[model samples]
Target: MPPSNRPIHARPQAMRNFRNEMRSATMSELTMPVAASPGRLDEAIAAFSRAIGPEHVHTDDATLAEFSDPYSPSSWDDYRPPVVLQPATVEEIQAIVRIANEYTVSLWTNSQGRNNAYGGSSPRMPGTVVVNLRRMNRVLEVNDELGYVVVEPGVSFNDLYAYVREHGHDVWIDVPDLGWGSVLGNTMDHGFGYTRYGDHAAAQCGMEVVLANGELLRTGLGALGAGDGWHVSKRGFGPSADGIFMQSNFGIVTKIGLWVMRRPDFYIYGFITVPQPDDIAALVEALRPLLLDGTIPNQPEVFNDFAALAEGAKKADVWPNPGRVPAEVLDGFRKKSGAGAWNLRFALYGREEIVDVNLAAVRSAIAHIPGSTVNGQKLRGDDREAIEALGQPGQVQAGVPSMSFLSVMDWVGAKKPGHVCLSSIAPLRGADVLKIRDIVRDACAEYGYDYGTGITLSPRHLTHISTLFYDAEDPVAVRSAYDFCREVIVKAREAGFAEYRAHIDFMDHVADQFDWNNHALLRFNETLKDALDPNGILAPGKSGIWPKRLRVK
Candidate 1:
């Protein structure tokens, strides 16, 4: 049999000491960029202050700690920046870039700094200055006819949703699990949502980027001055430079034009449950044809009983025993909660008749699964109160955003709970889903942790999201989670799979796995980095694309 799984309990005294050490370290020192001289760094700070006001240039420990990665597996000292500059406009960002280049100081850019799982506002390399675009919040254009919205980096999902609702627009904004993150930032990171416009990157049309050399460039039709089709036309002339900027250090995106969905007359929100653990294979197999036929309009999420449980209750409350919970215990909880071993949730949008037809198709497809059930309610698109009442899961699929999903972080019941996510893409096949699931679940079990994960199925592909939650205050637990994540990445890659995105700690590792022809892709990325940011000043280590100066020859 397997080794007995032991519980990793949080030690209060150790945690207190750790917090004290972090506080003292942050309070006493300011870490300057690796190669930046004191005099040049001071000059850059002064220039930044002058360009964006003294109040926006922050060097205090409190502010720095606030921007550090709360979920980082390593110490905050590994990722914390010495200074943070908040720019309010595109011109201000350009000025900051120029100042950074002149001073030989690297910059890490973030919008609202709420991407907690992937590193929040923390820079990939410590000692780099952070360029926060929170102050540049603005919704520049909302074209109802064209079904698109042009927004700055600072505009959050909540902000955009409120704007559309306040103005009584007939369009809806597709948001991720959390509503507080910047829309442009999330889109740039290739984040996904639940609706038909779930593919955030694909929905993007135009971009306004501030290059490393302090030059401003508008992509797509935005290249044309006063072009009416800037937000509508995705491809303008020849080369599409918008993709090069995403998840790269090539440029800091100041503005973006994203396509939104017009409100349908009605929408049908539904859930399907399968009793057996391995029944997910059959469920995916059944849904594949419907998804391929365009019968289901939105991405469907399949969650194990443990994942569904973690969303509402803490692990200690349900299964106090350490390591992975016994299968019988999980089955008991599932029975008590009237949930299945595998639960699938999805939504269909259109007119009443159209949704009805699709709903019937979905039911007929999944009917073959033994001991399976399907249920849901159809709501009017115009009924705001009804939609909001549907809660986070339902509201998100209907184009409303909520922070309720953040509760999963607290499932470990720690005062300072945190998690790192490992999301890998697989073909939309039942066997592929099962393969990825077994790999991740077995790894979690071996690491003395419960398998807390789910799969988000798109039409052609599926995203396997495995969240490793731990007590951020416990160094041992943090390190264990980090190691577990790295091991999972290696295992997935060996099985011919790779992550869509990764946390700051694993960015390099993940990028290294995409080594086709002796890392030809990374070589090309380096070439671009050297050309665009010759000084290697803008986000040096983002997505494992480092500048020539930083790379070991």
Candidate 2:
């Protein structure tokens, strides 16, 4: 394939100069020999040429910049890879891994070449191979009978949706709103959707992974190859290796086996709106029974007032430009609550009877919250209206819809800003969730910055804290956001809550929260990294999960 068409828009001269300066400093650092550097990058390029032809490898500055930053409009930092290699086959991928191992260089795999906020398409570790997996994109196999699909790493949600629809299958593809993300990449990163198959992690049944040493391994029934490569029945024959590769830079996942959902007879998508900040604890208590009983089915995250309004208001080009509900519209909602702008979205499934039963239970629970009510659907409008509105600029909603202010990230403009998201995981218990939320909110206020937050509650009663959004253009605000994030993280740690997600900058700090003496998982990752990329090459500083050199911190 030819090189990617570079983005038409370029940053201002001053910003560009700064970027170039940063790149120069980075290059100088990379050039410093660590014991001994690998073979010349020219030789590495030549090796790539041999594997998939010379045209497939790219080393130019322009091309490198294109793959450097995730398209996150709120992020300012860019990670430039010394070289990029696009391979079309598993053999080629294995070959590249072999070459990287031989040269003691890093290799970063990105699917469909779009990684958005969490360093989309950018190498988590700078100077990594920056493997762009777009060329390998293919729906390798779709087993209707087995209710699973085998796809290459680069296969996207749009690809799967089209395939499934064209094949005339009743199966439903669990798609995030932005149909561009790779199926494998999203699942590996624990991305969530809004369907019965909401949890992408749960949708994954098996995977075809390229270990650090360039060996191929398959998990679950695929380990058995075990019958047709197209169908994988068992979850796992031994210890599950699929989970290990996810959120870890230990291996390059070239393919995956995902379980798709069958369309259900009943479906409901709407929000429960509330106004007061203090009512959150009561709301949490109300959600407990539904979540625990699995009546709610999938993940149901809570979005506070600011987050809810932002989601609906993002696409201001729509008919209801700033889709704000009238203050009176929410009357009788949670006991005459003023329109404070909070909405909790949820869905109920199964037979109509079961759904009705569940809805009744939901209403009963809502009754307990002082200022909450099951609201009419504001997000659901006529198709024509929705489609027409989508054509307007600044009205697009990318990826999955979340109540998180991060959903409104596109408003920031072309130059993506840099942000550090510090998320703490706490038990979904009402008291703890409220405590953390209050703590984070207060910290943000202390810094004279409004908090941009989102929350996700796990079925097992774990809550993921999200503190996102800050202006990278303003160094002061950026520093404030970073400091506030760190403060919240520190508070969470002191309160005995561990973090669930992190960026590379905060990985060391996150690890410090865990016990180094008896941390089995950390130790296990270390052993695995040694066994695989023994030279400590692949994604050297990603989340501190691997690379012995970075692990010293």
Candidate 3:
């Protein structure tokens, strides 16, 4: 049978059936390392089952495998959690943590586990249990007047978008490339989107965290009244604690307050295509001033011809022959794309008059490029057909979310389709982008892989994220893909850059790149880890920042 035609939001029927079919793995079947004895592990499982109920405690290998990283290049056995737990309330989570500490067991936490890049849903250690929070989904509040929403970890981008639309709220939320991903999870990972609020972590106001010690704490204004008036004051009195929790294992964020934008009357999509690769520098310089002066408020993402033509594009467009398309054939795609060697995609949001004024200003900014092409289109946010016409990543820019980005996976993944992403932050210089692109492409070529790369822009910096696809069914291909990612990180670090995010296996590699002042950052993180989680049981090796007992290396 062909793949399910159900929309991306729907759960596959097979998955539903698989969830119901599970049996507990006995001591004989265990493969990974576990510090506790089999009898102790069984007792801990019983304790966890008592906390959240046996129905939610999944010890079966079939169900446990589902919680492992789907795109992991290494064997899933290395990262698979022994059991899965689903806790619906903070009290339940607190109880679960207490039980973990009692048995000295590790527990991994995930919101929706849909962020496929960087080891989706899987824990850093194999002996841990996956705490899946999909059942705790709830939209606690949507403040139309203040333009913010308070949501749980289970709330997906689609769920929030649907709620706002159904209620006819005149507001929009900045969403990342993938809509099915958890809103809180994406923000916590400091994920990027494509609007003014694209810097998701910066947009977060308050948080409710469940500490490793089974203590409930709130950050920012949330500390007051257990997060009362959280929306009103994103930053509370004294030092802000919100920054510490992101991408760290100090605590599990149960709820968050996210800023939303008031729907603009005129939403304009604009693009500038420069024919020559060298022109990318000139274009970057031209837009830098606009971005600084707020002429363009949104984060501008620039793509090479490969990214422009291949993303959400049909598989047959540039396949059959592999390893980077030839220049002549690439030029054909450029012609079809109306983009030269580089394409800059951005949006203008405001009233019709303000939008009209900005379009002229925008054209003037890019007027210096000789063969550059500038185009503009009005995005009617309320018009479904018009928004659909914009297509994929563009739809995301318009604050309309979709899983169209998945098309790339379908096109690239041969018999066994999977991708591992590595990203780094760089100065917003066209020359730098050109330099990094060469480094990334050459490294990928060395591994006989396609360098599917893209550059997402902020006001002063750009993030370079590349996807290395491999056949999951083939272990050698998977190993090659992992090696390619490691090589990419090494080259980037040698050039004085750092990975913004990394896969579970390479978290240590990315952290090692921060050697300034004898790796002071890691030391500081360790100090806090010891103070907050003295038991040293919360996500030990995450981001390579381990507590005292486990930081042997």
User: Which candidate gets the maximum lDDT versus the true structure?
Assistant: 1
RMSD of each: 6.9, 8.3, 8.3
Candidate 2 lDDT tens digits, 1-553: 0011111111122223444444434333322323124455656767778988889898787777678654332233335667888899889988988877666667778787665545566665444678888888788777767677788888887777677657766555666546677888888777766566677787787788888778888887777754674344536556877787877778889888887655445544535756577666677777877888888765666666544433434322322323233334334332443434445667665566777778778888788666567842222212324422432111112112222334466433325544556567777777887778777777766654445455665555555545455444554555555456656787888877877656544454465466545666666767887777787766655555556653322
User: What order do candidates take by lDDT, descending?
Assistant: 1, 3, 2
Kindly indicate the candidate among 2 and 3 with the higher TM-score: 3
Q: What are the per-residue Cα lDDT tens digits for candidate 1 across 237-294? A: 9999899999999999998999988998998889999998788888888898888887
lDDT of 3 by residue, 1-553 (tens): 0011111111122222432332243323422234234665789899988888899999887787678877753354766777889999999999988987888777778899865868888877656678888888999998878888899999999998898888888888888888998899899888878878889898999889999999998887777776358876777889999889998889888999988888787788888888897787788888888888888988877777777666766445666665666678777877775667888888988888888889899999899889988888986656666876888756888778888777777666455477888798878887787777788878867767666667787778888888777666566666667667777788888886678888776676577677677778877888898898887777766777666654432
> How big is the RMSD of model 1?
6.9
TM-score of 2: 0.80
Give candidate 2 misplaced runs (Cα > 4 Å): 1-39, 71-78, 228-234, 312-341, 376-407, 413-420, 465-467, 472-480, 516-518, 549-553
Best by TM-score: 1
